[model samples]
Target: MTNGPRVVLAPDKFKGSLSAPEVAAALAAGIRRADPTADVRCVPVADGGDGMVDAFVAAGWKRVEVAAPGPTGEPSTAVYAVHGATAVVELAAAVGVAKLPGGRLDPLGSNTYGLGVVVAHALDNGAEEIVLGLGGSASTDGGSGLLRALGLRLLDADDRELDGADSDVATLLGRVSSVDRAGLHPAIARTGFTLACDVDNPLLGPAGAVAVFAPQKGADPDQMTELEAALTNWAAVLGTGYAEIGGAGAAGGTGFGVLAVLGAQVRSGIEVLMELLEFPSLVADATLVVTGEGSLDHQSMRGKAPVGVAAVAKAAGVPVVAAVGRTLLSPGEIRAAGFVGCYALSDLEPDPALSIAHAAELLEQVGERIAARRW
Candidate 1:
């Protein structure tokens, strides 16, 4: 094996166990076990959902706390990071599904209003640009609630304000007064807005927002139908082209609402994350790159963090290895997804909960094994 002194350790959190920082620390520990003098740099990654603030903080962004609404219509506080004039808003921090109580899981009543509150906070804080992380949402309101919070009202046939869910959009049979856009932060008009999403579901169809994601949000068959109908009506009202917009189904049509109403652009969450971390530049001088996430499966091939990191490493001509919590893909699938090789923590720990509980130790051990390997 070549005695190269360069190595880059970039990994996402194991989820429910270690955070991105902890994962990097464990991986670094393992790499050092193999070569005491190796040059290693750890840049933890996130797909715009969980650990996003930490990722930005690790990259030296300033953190600010703001008040936003929770999924249950209660006031909650969220933190965002600011780098220069850009403010990073993570929807998960505002209205994540996990925040909803078990018995109160009502997709029909839930909304992205809390997310709007976060955006408003960011704008008020003097951000010139907004980078919205659209993951881990609990609403299927087609972003209507979010827009309303930002001053866009959804009026029904009698011009009364509509309630939650995209299905409510169908009740509007005519034109309504334009929302007062003047109150919006001046920076919003001049500044760019980017949405970070991993899913590719369009706004409304078989593979679109309602059909694909509503069930996960606790929608029943009837509610899903209502939601789809509302989205269709809402699309007609806005006249925004939802036809080819991929990922419109993400975050219960939050993607759709943001694009149509707010004029936001969508990008791969992982791609955005990698660029934010400046991963390519970091891995360029490294002889090897290691990345991993909670699960390695077919979905990982579809723009998840680890695969995104691997793509960057591959472009730099650095071999990438993964130490995953579990292996859900076949051997062929893993190689095809741009990983040099993969190791499962489950293989070492056996029990799922135990594997997560000791994820750091397991990752460190796997990292040691990789460092010892003569490749």
Candidate 2:
């Protein structure tokens, strides 16, 4: 029953380990153990990727469970969050590469049709604002599958429907003649669709999705070349320059194709999630803010959740400390990003795998150490 500095805890998920809420709760517990008098506020955040549904659910949104399409063209039941007129959906949930059998990676065969199914569900259920998190996708298609799902006709030169499920990438993209919008869902035109994009890569060029990200998805040089050429053609037929738009390469070109269809707006995923949670108002009077993620690196500054939290706390004149599983950036780099301090768990444990295996214990220690620092 004591009052100390008000601390806000906002962290992204620890990649393959803890969820954002779990990380926040563990840190908060450690902080409380170190100083029972410390006031702590726990708010989870994401960079418009995984953990989005959980974050919104923690923020009081209803978790709506339904079956959407997986990357392999099969029905994969995934969950999306809905509250009032706003609906939150993650492309990964519906069409993540993890959905492939035996973790089979298929860039050409994968599609976004299941994602479109979920979007239609949200619209039919009265959602006006659709927030689409674009990350962890396994496909490299130019969102042609999603268009097909929404009743758009993807045709070849012979007026035959292009089969996203059965056809390979070469056949699908190489044969695409035109897109028919006559069957597009009516709600698609009226609803405000926003893409939660973390990366800034456009749809084409060296930094495009194919060149930069396709390798990780099991694409060889030949596959990448073909996919790139196919994506270029798909964009040409779609009749929009979404290919050059920043963030257009996200989620296998879901950003480009979806944005082209509705003229959607792109925003930083972390900022969108924070604003959705009203995080600034929650931390306005806090003495300090604590945030972190799995890794602190040069990329973290480029729109990751921790950096986003640091921006808000710094604006409110609150000091920020981050506790991370590991760090690839120098202390100066983090300091320049407005983080006053960071605790690295990788240093605490010598074994890399053991560190992630025991991340919870190490993170709690970090929280205690951060709290015990004499202020």
Candidate 3:
């Protein structure tokens, strides 16, 4: 133990490769193989998406069930985690893109009505503060649906309730009522709302949510442009200009909705996760830290999980190494972003699918080799 380097196996999930806990477990296996008594700490993290429940659960949060709307306007029940008085709400739980069937991938028709249901449930359950994870959304309603579910009214030019369809925006003339602050749990009105998002794209622009993300949500070129225009108009009606808010475009405009309508304060999803996990203090005593995600590329430089981890390690003057599934950025680019080195799991196994299937084993092997080299 004295001869081996003290390491922390902190990594986000490799997406299709491994879960965060599994990644930590595999890294622990490799560390132990290299030095039987090596000190290793595993703190799995997520940027408020699929792995959020696992991360919060591991950190001692209590899970609660609530009824919410589904992606297709059906009734659904979702789960939120409570840590002390704070509630954790993940948009993915109610209306993630994964919840939609391949045949029903209609961005225009889907809405964030389910998200409002979850928030209302949290408030009713005595949660004062909300930590909303606005990642992996399936809706494109510009939050109008969510506001409607929360008791706010969206009226057409003729003063009728508007549907969540894309065509409804053209008919929407204004918001007719204020948010229902009544019966708002005493804890909620005074509590801070922290929104977690990974993207930096603003509400509306070339790099905004619709332009950059609508294609992935199954929008054609025309639909993308139309959605952008619609959301821009929606923002105008709400009197909140989202044209320049960073991360405003996240989660198919859900970010803009929560920020504008709910009065939420935004923070980088990865940065919030790091703070929640107390990553800075953990890195201070470690000699080396290993972190990665499914892919590491030029985009990683702009606040992705791996880069967030590297930033913490870099600040503590610890050497950070990344073992990723693929490398889109060169070694120099990674180094400049604060990672000392990067190794690809794909290089060790040429087949992409095989590498993902054997991710835990590959990561463990990589960790063991790195530890051995240090020794």
Q: TM-score of every model?
A: 0.90, 0.96, 0.89
**Backbone clashes, each candidate:** 1, 0, 1
Candidate 1 lDDT: 0.78
**Where does the lowest 10-residue lDDT sum fall in candidate 3?**
169-178
Tally clashing residue pairs in candidate 1.
Answer: 1
- Model 3: how far residue 300 lies from native, Å: 0.7
Rank list by lDDT: 2, 1, 3
Q: In candidate 3, what are the lDDT values of residues 243-267, reduced to their tens digit?
A: 4688777777777776776678889
Q: In model 1, which runs have C-alpha deviations exceeding 4 angstroms?
A: 1-4, 102-104, 160-185
TM-score of 2: 0.96
lDDT of 2 by residue, 158-249 (tens): 89888665778656887888878888888887789888979988888898989888888889999998999888888888764778888899
CA lDDT, every prediction? 0.78, 0.86, 0.75
Q: Taking the tens digit of each residue's C-alpha lDDT, what string does model 1 give over 116-157?
A: 888887777777778888887887777776787777766555
Off by over 4 Å in 2: none
Error of 2 at 121 (Å): 1.0
The top-ranked prediction according to TM-score is: 2
When 1 and 2 are scored with TM-score, the better candidate is: 2
